[model samples]
Target: MKYTEEQLASIRHPRGHSVTFAVAGSGKTQMLVGRVAWLLQQGVAAKHIRLLAFNRSARAQLQDRIRVALPMGAEMPRISTFNSLGHRLCELFEREQQLPRHELSTSEALLKKMARRALVDALAAGNEKGPVSAEMLDDFVAFIGLAKADIEPPDVVLRRLPAGNGRAFFCDAFVRFERNRQERRVRFYDDQVRDPVLLMRAEPATAQRVTNKFDVVIVDEFQDVSRVQLELLVILVGTRAQLNVVGDDSQCIYAWRGARPEFMGRRFDTCFPGATRYTLSRTFRFGHQVSLAAAHLIRHNRHRADTLCISAPSTPNTAISLVKAHNTGQQEAVVEAIAAWCRRNGARRQVAVLARLWAQLMALELALLEHAIPYYKPGPALFDLPELAGLLGYCRLAAGTLFAEPRAREVVRAMLTTPTLFLSANALDNLVEQILSAPEQAGRLIADAAPRKAPNWKREPFYLRAELWRAAQHAWTGKGAADALQVYAVQTGLRKALEGDATDATTEKRLAYETLLHLAQASRATVTEFVAHMDRLRASQRDYQAGSDEILLLTTIHQAKGLEWPCVVLTGLEAGAFPGKRAALEEERRLAYVAMTRGRSQLFLVIPPDAHFQANMEGRPPPLHGKPSVAVSPFLYEACLPASIELGAVLHQCRPEDVGAVRLPAAPASNQALLQRYLRAVASSAESSGAT
Candidate 1:
């Protein structure tokens, strides 16, 4: 709870208009709370102080902090999001201005569905060719959302688009979506800000009336605020009100969601030219190496202000590491590293594995579950998805079941429902009984039971599902298990059964299946072993330690932003995977900066060792060259740390006999060159000294 000199200076800023550049792990919330308490002591009324947050979660965090920062029964300050406060402004004069208050449509889940529907309809009507892709739908939705925030009509939005029918297609979708909104008279997220901006601009008296309601405004996470949201604050601060905003420009990774970081780096300073600026660069969360690593990576970005700073050095001496491994071995290596971190610290769980794409996370999830490491995923648990379950069932069914295995029954239940067999459960149960009763001749029993096939099996009187299941069972080991899974997919009408209405969610389901196959190949885990692993996980699902607060967290880098853990691991650090195919290099570099900073004590960057190896990036778009081939990401090189090989080797008492042993690549060898040397030595040493 100790405040640094920089933090204390930022906390006591005399207010007019001010911006605090709180770098990563700089305890932004504490500084903001400290300043608010300072303001209250300076006679600023709590009722007159408006503390705005970027989102509901942040608003709640602020509310919690305020309670702790102030004494019991202290006057509570006004706290809300920018949109909520703006919406209230419009509401204040709704009746006087004859403005109709549209009911806010706040459910993102429902809106995504409706938005997809509108885009599909528009694309179909416009004679657009091709399957309606998730990217196309997302692009259309982003356009509509941005257009509304800019208060631009469909035509204005069209002129701003890149040269393609996408402009027209997106515009068409926007018009259709706006019409739907009008018909329903429901306010979307953008409308909450857009309507108020329009209201205030059209009527200065209304703006003044709203501004008169508050004397001081403090906003957190201002880096992610869009242009319109900034405009609302500018209007409210018009000459009279005091403004104080704290955010990290380096952490501005939400550009895809329409957040404008320019507002944080440049626009805010221009809008309030005389604003008192403070840079709280002393990061209290991490030590020297973490600070230096984040600094090196983030400095490459074109935007972002403030120099990275470290609080104090400590034991476990915070370090950034680069791991070179094969596609399969990478997962295993990460698991071992995490287990070792926990063991060394004598800790339970304060670790996270963050990646840009879900593919990496999915692969790690399997590895973690197999080892029984208690971890919490933020969104949908991939293993719990029906698509995965169905595919798992196919493998389990093909692998066959014995009388003693309870998992076989679960597999049967999943198989029956996932793909309809056009037969009663009793019939399927009898077939399973036959297979179980006659283990050696189960194939013969199935073949005898199957009816003769017509020239066109599709037109056969009997459903071919059972016969297909039998055919899948013929090859049920190793790669053959994965092969059988594909057979089941094709025979079962995978698109019809698993893909629902061609939505993006189904796209994820499809990709998830691909990840499952990847997991199968990497682990070479038998169906029985897979089931047993899952059974152990489920059995301990309610165990106290398993349910304890975030032992191991697996999430995307975007979700990992604004969160910190004692140890953090960033997976898929290969060229295409980390920078990503669609996003800009600078943005991706910023992502790397954000990712590395999340670790308070340790940071590990896991990359596939060779170009031939594909680090699991299934769900995302392929790199332009085709499939992503492994290459050293520039961000990794930016960190300037020695390959962890020497340190690790030293720790295991297996140092390379000489540095000369590292094979220099034909062209400019990197850390991977050193890792190759280390791995070769480790393999040899493990056979003798029993060191891993």
Candidate 2:
């Protein structure tokens, strides 16, 4: 809670303009909040302040902190994510220009669909041409960035054009694409930000209004800001918006999404010539060993430097351990061992197993789940649109019935058998046929399709229709569904359902009602559209689930940003796995840096002895620790400490001294023990039984 000398100095010198380049876990948000609180105490009006974040979740967290830190009824600063702000400004322009709000934000979902079609059409146009390559697809996407919600439209590409003619051809195609978008009533994200800037630039009064309304502007996650985003900020500030920019260039792992950290590093100086720069180099999250490891790993990257202020001598003492598993099974066994160690060491409840890839976490999760571990997985939102809609649909159909209780059952069913959500079209048809033919009765079919519950959830119903809905809705809507319309609907619906009988609401039900309200609000007053919207939502949900390693944390290195766990076991640190044979560019280096930095204290690096070994006759490698050893990640050796430890020899030594040596069966791994504990807790809970 206390700030360092540098942080204190920055706080003491709050002026008209400043830039704070903060690293991840430097309590950037807390500092920002403190700065705001200081200004308010100095009598800055809330109406004249605005806080802009890179994403909604960050904005919400900031807002929550502001409300709690300030006095009751204290004025709240206007907070919004960049996209939201851009969307609003676009609306204002539409009103002023009397034009329909430009449909910008060509969602990647939409563009990918169109791009595939376009690619196919282009291919058909040249039947004699050779087959398309993945590189072609990548180039095509680059020519025109993939569209996302509120993203700018990508420029178009022309096939069969000479290399020299590519630019001109794309420019023309880009213009045509924009014209087509207008004709077709579709908007891309570029239009959302671009139109607003143009409008405000042309209208001094409008720009002045925004600039004047917010006396101080704070932009977090600035390293991810695009040229377009920077322009928007400039308009709001109008050469004097008093700006604060905070982010870590080393953690800019979103270049594929159009982020340019260099722009952030340079633009503040270009925009505000006299702006002072403040750097937060100290990290309070990771232990000294882990931090040093990270610092060493990142220091090798050409884009990163030792002067980034990553060193903090005051950090706790913790060592990074390297574990070599003969195979994934062996790796999982090691994880289980560690989890057990944590529990026995008195921090079972506080430990986490973080992985660079969700696929890499599965073995640990399965081992833990089979063993019944009790732990919470915190990464991002759990239920997605498609999953939420499906759950709600089933809940609606089976409200207060055995079928619809505890919402997740329906999701499990959809995952296994429903074509509308997870199962492939053919697979779904086959499943339906099997079900209809009574190969399995409805009850059995439901059971077969059901997802195995995580041991911890046995006492907690996976499907709390109202609560699930609320969580899903809030995640999507950026707020709780407690507005007038939602409240009225809930009151009226509950009244009808209860037949006017008065009953006390339990905590779960209350949460459920709130979730239901959010879902209802997100449904946009149209059940059909809501259902349709859920497909993408469900797909994304499935993608996220697929990415995770069961109870273990599974996500891409990029996804691991802004998060740190007490214990991190990074699997697949070998050549192909770490750098990823496919990702040889500088971006891959940045991603490696991000992944290496996620550990708080205990760090375990799992390396497979060989890349081509098969653990079983099935010829399939174990799930999480797949085949290993083709190459080691360069960073592993490059970033080694002066007293570097070797895992290869240690693992070999852990094996029996000789094949003939007598040994008792090894105990279950820590992950397995944790899983067992969780399962026992959930299984014994009356709530889980009742829900089921």
Candidate 3:
């Protein structure tokens, strides 16, 4: 594909250390890919080109595009997410430095556990160091320490530290954590980014390896790069590393994840001294009306650069429209109504629902169930389900027993009494506690139980343990019997326990058995590994599902970054709904922005008709008190409402009766079969028409 003059200019220019600022829908990915291709064309070896993506999915996309664009025999450049890049860097640096592998690769929970252990060891040995304070604990718990993406310093930690012991505890833990990591010669995710920056500053050989070794370095999503990331990029490229960075400051929504959009505006000049700037003014996604709506909303943002304030040029699309519902129920009804409309309009397969919260999505699901509509959910809810949690835990346990540990026991106990098997929560918890407290007695009680009991084994602790042991044995042999063993464990009352006096010998025996089972499972499972896997799934499952065209997206606004759909409906847009009662922070602004921009051609923000029912019933003064203004977002008011109403639109007449019916259509003929028949008919008609 031939590049536009602008694209070529950005790629060809030899201006020192310049970065390209790319906006959403401006095709930053395509530009980055083009630059790589251009480098190869200019006699740069593919092996010497490196492409870095901030996230895994983006990395995969970059790799796919490279494969598609490169010649059949051409070598692929090194491509990786930032963490993966750090992993590579650590590996090479370790070989050079002759460092021992570190324990930082352990699960975050385990690492923390070890850190605490180190702290305890230091104190117990009369080291008089590393004391934790209440304030430091507050900070640690707030963000749960820094994410791999968060490269920010420990200022947050430092500020939260209490005097004396608290300060000492934090300092000790941090120092010990670093020492442990250094001793092992392994790098944590944070260390990967941090150490590279250090190496570039102190180690000339390492700096040369990253900088002089590569012919070109192309960075996408430059706006969200953390300070460490920027440092790594600077060291790798320097003034003459042939740098190409592309990002949109307006869309830099990852500040909480340690990204600094302001850095782009400040450092781009110094980093890429005398760099040329190119702007792509046209958007291919939104039509004139929708573009105007977006432009109107974005221009009001005080943080955006003046250049980004101008309206985007129109493209092939339709006007973005607003559909109002008065309350959450009514809003969901509208979502159903819109889904039905899409079916009627022949776009059912292309429709998606974007929500600002899981509760909103639950409202949508309830609406869909009410409408009897068949939809593939495309959000975070799937991974959150208890069943999914159980399955993933099992997978982790199976992947490596060393990772399974306490999780195996916890999940086993929970599954036995969960709704699937119907054991009471109290009964199950008592049994689990007993099993943990006295493993030997728990086993005997389970085996002695004559009743079949709950399939989850809530009745017989010993039986449950035995069953779990069997499952682990089956898993170890790589047999397909693990699921069956789980079923058996539940079926045999091994999952349940009978209610009795505290001193019941049968219960004691059952508890012992369960403990035995737990020990057996733990023998094969790694607590550290399981926790790590679970953590990964917890964070990424939503993103994994969102990319699928198969699942209907049902997610909160905060979850739907970098995703778009051909059809999108935002439901529950009432006073206490869309804006949410507590969304007073900038989170609300970003949530609305994320929800609005997810649409490709059609967008609907539904406000329920009975929005005032609660306030009216509560006898609280009406919203805006007596003025009774509709709670449409101020950002959306002007564009969605007519001009005669002036700047902020007022609540119009309530269309209480317009609460349209939500119908779940009868299952249609198989889409694949129908498509086949339609194609066959088209072919025959065309052939006959030619003869005629």
Candidate 4:
């Protein structure tokens, strides 16, 4: 647990204001823990220190490390994700503020529902430019999130947009949405994070409570902060409390939520005067080859801070190789390379297959299924799909009508939170409370809750109420469960909803309906038994996650951040695939840099035959095109891997039988078995291993 000199310099610096520029795999986490321990040694109270992580996963990791680093029976400093801290503060003062407690926690869909209502009001008031549909509201929602994150007012953002962007109507609606939120005390994820910044600026008393709560504030992943987050940090660091930010400017790849790398470097200096800067220059994660490749690619990005990081001395000088499939062999080549890696190295070494889009993973998924190679992907479970979950929800509600199964409040909450209905938080609570208040009148609640013709002023309430009633009636049929589901989908307009809702591809849309029908075939038993079977299937996924130690991580590049593996197979490296259509080239290069550095031992790049083929074709691809479809990524050239690199022999040569031959991971060892292994090793060393 010894710290490097570079890390020690930052941890032991005199407490005022400082920024630790930590590169990838530079062990900044341990340095953060060390800074806390140093504060304790400087006679600072643990209660006066606050550790803020950017996300829940980072918070959990920091908490685990704190326990390992600090002494037992010691008081720990307060640790929380930024939003969770906001949630805690809201919980404490909400009663006094007269906030809508249940409605405070919202979702993206419901937020758009709010925006959709605001847009309609704007249109009626003669404020909008032209007609707009629900499909186009994605931009409206995204604009609101980005504006809130940047602390930009509607007028300011409106001035920045082009004249003919077709989104001028949203500016007026934005103002109306804020008015609605402030009047009702309702907020979504972005609003929740910005609440503290707004509240502290508005009320001096609230600011005093927050400022007095901590003496020293340290933020992890500070490079990923939005403008509002930077403002919140400034408030906490207001001329008194010591503050430290630890992050890498080069690895700031999250531009979607208003994060740019320059904020951690130049912005740090501008915002906090005379803040000391420290850098962690040695990465112990990947070897020399990966370090060089990542450095080469990221330097192309115009916005990064100029800092040098070297590979560890103990790290190997591994060669980052390439795999080019001439035609229909992209999936087959990838699977072969993956299996070859597992065989050459130990199976226990983790390998990650990363891509730019989910569509890319679809092609790779078919390869795994063909070979029956077990892999893991952190995606939506089959039963958790909206259409599927709705059917289950109906079945559960239907079964409830037959018996007194949901006498408990939690069971009712479960039914209310299902995928089909997206109600305003306040309206949902009112329905649930009524059921609890009048247990005897529960049967009539769904049927009588919504009126025939809903009011025109507000949205979500009417639709939710009406849909719940109709769904309940349709599911309550005396027919079999599958037949009831079919009736429910038709009567409740679920099919129509899916068709119009934001489906990316027609194939995916058809897939959901096909899955619905397939699920219906299994719903032959009563609705209650079918629900239990679905629950059991979900439970088995957890066991499947623990199925093998040699698990293949199938995930997107965005999800692969803040994580590393021994071997990495990056697929779909074609021109239009990795750079994507909407992303800027510089930002795309940063993303590619992040993916390259995620390896410890090997980095294998794959150029599929064609981006169009992999995305458009779901099955075995046809022969290679005359000119070989789309070229390999321009970023691959940045890594010194050109599109015309010599084709390796075994890249497309591995047989499917060899892939299927690798065994599943063995079960864990028992106590006696472990003891015998230990005894055998000790006996060979000329010692009495164990008692006879």
Candidate 5:
């Protein structure tokens, strides 16, 4: 954990303002922690320091690091994500101005819905440029978010829009969407920065008060900050507080989300005059092979700083390998390779399978399942689980009915017949049909059809029905969804019913309940708003923790950032798959760089012989008219050539069935041994060339 000279300089740089161009795996977080400690040593009060991270998880990590670095009794600085900070600011502003307190909806789904409604209204008014489908509405909503991030005015956005029939329609829809937000007194996540920046500009005294709230501000992942976010930071610092921004421009992969990497470069200098710049190039995550390959790959980017000064690892091994397979069967080979490595190294928890997209992991997941390999997929949030869907649905129905605005009856029928109730499928279907057939007498019919037997009392479907009805009644009495769920679970032994005997299942059910309770506690709103929030989250498709640590990780490269594995497998290394047909080449290269650098001691890039055919045909062999093969990505060539290696000749080629027989060669036992072997190989190669 010794700090490098560059890292120390970054930590102790002049205090007015500064920017750190920290490369990936360069221990940026460590330096940030060190900077906090250094500031404390220089008589800065921890309570006056503000550290902003990109996400809650990162913020928590920073908080942990800061606490560990400080003396036990030292006060910790305020650390939060930008949105959390905005929420705090909003609260303060509301109290000061006596404005109506409102809730912030960070759900993109809700924003999309609002935008869609506005577009439809515009179309109804005979606007020829209106969006015609839900997909188009989604795109327009995303564009609006990006525009706001860029701090672009509506006229600027209109001018930049492609000359299309929908330009006028979109402009009107955007204005209507803003007006709707004002009427609802709600704020989205982006407005956390947007509104605060607006307020600061409008009220100089308030801005001064805000700036005085902090003595220093440190922002992580500064490369991904949008223009409005930068503006907010500038306003909050306001030539008084020391400002420190840390990020790597080469790692700016969120351009589609309106991240302007240039802000971390020249724009930062312009905003904070006399700001010192520092770069941390020494990486401690990956070994020499990974560092070399990543440096080579990212240097191809058109906009980047100087070449990274990659420090060679003391225990550098032959960590990089190219594995070639024939077709879809290669997934099994990949699984076998993983199993073999796990057996030899006993580090399954430190291994991962990273792909470009989530869909690409389907075959790998199936293979891992077949092999009985423990794996985690980052499932949906607790409320979105299929097992809990019934509970959520029932709560929503009850809440909706209280307002006299229930959803479709079919939805109600589905909720009543959910598999979690353990009702006989045929009987439930019959009951639903009867209910649909006789809507007026549905309640009476349900009571009449309810089973009367109690032989297996707890397991009886009648008992489940009664419990759900009871929960619904409680919900109707104004109990929140979380409370109602807890009541139902306890009253009917629902947890025991769902858990059965499996320990993992029992643990998952318990965690789901705990998660529900936590969500309920965090939301201070009414039952209806809570239910609506849960519904919107379910619709958003965001991944949540699977609550298991002893499992192999399967995730996209994007999700694998800030994480490292001892053994890493990069799948689908073909042109169309890795680079993707629609993505910019530079972005794809950065992705490859990120993937390569994730490995600490081992890196395997798998290239299927028919990659093109598999990608085109969805992991199946080519159809009758499909192309026969795929070319290896140019990145592979770029990395392999300069490393003085003939990848194709040296790579181990095997079929799915032969994977068990293809073993990795034993590496040198010690760093000195490995360095000696490398030197000998170089000398021998030179001798052979001289003889030729």
Candidate 6:
């Protein structure tokens, strides 16, 4: 891993406050690691150097890289996520001040629920000016989160409440939330960062003492740093410690999560006067064709820096395709075509499918699964599975003492009618109806409705029902929700029932159970908190599986960041889909740029042939009754690339003369206009010669 000249310059830049604008796939992490090694070689102690990463995975990678860079017996620098660093600072402050430790709420959803209820109560008392809706509640909560990240005070938030109907309600709720948090000595996850900043501001001596502990501070992914995070860095560095920040502004896509890419621009120089700026523009991940396409697409963004540094061209006329599929059958046909291409090129593990949204990938996922394609979604957590909904519902019911609520009734009904339960449907329905009718006596009714013995080799449903009831009672008394769920799962033999068949369903259920066990081992929450966490997990549609790297990847463009594949399939490249009707045009263009850049050697952009063509459902094709109205994304035209072709003409048994002629958009008269035209001619020649 020899360093490029640009990377070496970034690593060895005069040591003061500096910012590095690292482009996508430009070895940012490698350069950062090199800089840390340089600092160590300059006599900076490992203990005095701190590195911050955006996530645990990134932190782990940094740690590994630093270890490799250091001598065999040398010590490693402190590397951690911002949240972890904040937690460490808070703990040290608490110990020094002799203050009691306060429990932090791990679940943001729990805090949101509390805030929503407070707003509802305030609105009921006529404190609000207009009607309150769920969307309003969600928006108010998000606003508060962002405000805290920006270090805004309650009065400032009240003054800036977006001039909406729930303004008064949001203000009231915000004030009440502050008061309640102070009273209970409870903090939200954001407070891990916020409280430390407050503590440092109120105690300059403490802040100075902490600053003395670090000689250099390096922040990765600085483009996504929120205002408060920047403030924390400033306080910690204290004009003495060397500060090095690295990130790419064009890759900053987390605006919804309080990220402010502007901070990575001129604000860096403002924060640290005379700070040097460096750019790592050379990308080693993709070839010239992919780079040119990405460069042209991102040229539309007004805020980005100059064009990316291009590498020398290789394999002249890179393989790029534009496929048109009309219906579900055609969509499946496209998948089959991809499979054929994979087999011919031996690129099964090097391919990925990137979509604009998760919903759009559902049908593709199903089609791949039906075709026995090995696919992997990196983080499909157990809680996101519909199969585990019943189990989670039962856990919630177990945590609640009363069984009269509608939620409790629904959980019981689902449990009784579960396929693994082997209970008669009519009997379960009658039992549920009785319990619903007599809400107050729901517990007694459930116990009485338990069926007798079933003529099977295994234990009966009656015994399982009794075990579940006992587990619920125990959970209500003292045991946590996680504990109760574990007990119920074991006693009911759910894992055994799900494991008998060696099929995909069995594999999924077993993996889900393993995830549940992992959760149980990690959780320290009480029953109520556990239930709330579970609720939050259910609301979030993240999923995870082991060995994901060995399968085909299907994910959103957002998730596709920081990743690359040899062959990439960009799906749903139509108007109102890729640009997305509600998204900012520049941001959407950046997204398209990101998707295009992920491909190393080959890229395929899939387009619907007609307005009626949709891939929204499983096994359902586009309606067969409409004229062709769907057009390729404006981005394809905007890129001015000429490698596009219809998929129908390029399938496995197709003749070279059947290749659909590509309609190249007129090249824009920008810096790359001439290059685009030259590339178009090359692609035209290649296509006519039957080159993929």
Please list the C-alpha lDDT of all candidates, in the order they appear.
Answer: 0.64, 0.51, 0.51, 0.64, 0.64, 0.64
Off by over 4 Å in 3: 2-5, 98-100, 103-152, 156-187, 202-205, 309-314, 325-332, 378-551, 571-591, 608-692
Q: What TM-score does candidate 5 get on C-alpha atoms?
A: 0.65
Per-residue lDDT tens digits of candidate 6, residues 1-692? 56766677889977788888887777788899889888888888888888898889989988897888788989888888989888877788778863347777787777876776667667767643333443355667776777677676755655543343436556667777767777778877777788888777776776876664578899998988887888888887886688998988777776545675578876676787777888876666655556556666777778766646343222223366666753122356568767876887775778888876654454455455445566766544333443454555566655663364345665666555332544333556677778657744555655565443424343355556655665565545456656766766676676666555433234334434544444555566656666666655433322323334456777889898888887888886766456765456776787788888787667887776644333211124556675556556778766645422221112212333432343333333473453544344334322211111
Best model per TM-score: 1
TM-score of each: 0.72, 0.59, 0.60, 0.66, 0.65, 0.66
Off by over 4 Å in 5: 98-101, 106-109, 124-126, 129-132, 154-169, 202-205, 315-318, 325-330, 379-550, 610-628, 638-692
Cα deviation of 435, candidate 1, in Å: 25
lDDT of 4 by residue, 294-401 (tens): 655666677877665555544544447777652123367778888988888867348888876554565455356546566788875444444344445567666654
Weakest ten-residue segment in model 1 by summed lDDT: 683-692
lDDT, candidate 1, at 222: 85
Better candidate by TM-score, 1 or 2:
1
The TM-score of candidate 6 is 0.66
What is the Å distance of residue 238 in model 4 from its true position? 1.0
lDDT of 4 at 360: 55
- TM for candidate 2 is 0.59
- Clash count, one per candidate: 0, 52, 59, 0, 1, 9
* Residue lDDT tens for model 5, 330-416: 366787788878888876788898876654554465445445566766633233343345555556656754223243444544455
lDDT of 2 by residue, 549-666 (tens): 3334445566667777766666656554455433434566667667666766566766555433222212345457554434456666555432222211221233223312323222
Candidate 5 or 6, higher TM-score?
Answer: 6
Model 4 misplacement above 4 A? 91-103, 107-109, 123-134, 155-164, 326-330, 381-550, 609-628, 641-692
lDDT of 3: 0.51
